[model samples]
Target: MSLRPVVDEHECALHGDCAEVAPQVFRIDDVAVVIGTGPDELIMAAAESCPSVAISVIDESTGEQVYP
Candidate 1:
């Protein structure tokens, strides 16, 4: 499955957890930014690691949210 990650800037605390979990996929600047594609599991892991719950994962095939 193709996963797309969206970062909610307002909710982000700039903790860099998401980027730490998946550096290839996320970068930390003012907030976490989706930088590239990664394995489904890795993407989900990154989203789940966000302390502020700022990252949302979507299943590209279904256009449905798969992670909180």
Candidate 2:
């Protein structure tokens, strides 16, 4: 499954938790940015670690939301 991580700019507060939890998948700057590809587990972990729920993981193959 190809999981893609996307950051919701409106909800992101630059907390960096997503980056801390999965640096390979997320990066902190003005807001969280999806930097590169990673395991589905890591991508989902990054999304779940966001305190603001700014990060969302989508299964590109299925068009399904994988994280809250």
Clashes of each: 0, 0
lDDT digits (tens) for residues 1-68 of candidate 2 = 99998899999999899888888777777888888998888888788888899887899999999787
Best model number under lDDT: 1
Off by over 4 Å in 1: none
Clashing residue pairs, candidate 1? none
Give the 10-residue window scoring lowest on summed lDDT in candidate 1.
26-35
Task: Please provide, for model 1 over 12-41, each residue's C-alpha lDDT reduced to its tens digit, 9 standing for 90 to 100.
Answer: 999998888899999888877888999999
TM-scores vs. true structure, each candidate: 0.96, 0.91
C-alpha RMSD of each candidate structure in angstroms: 0.6, 0.9
Local error of candidate 1 at residue 57 (angstroms): 0.4
Model 1: how far residue 18 lies from native, Å: 0.7
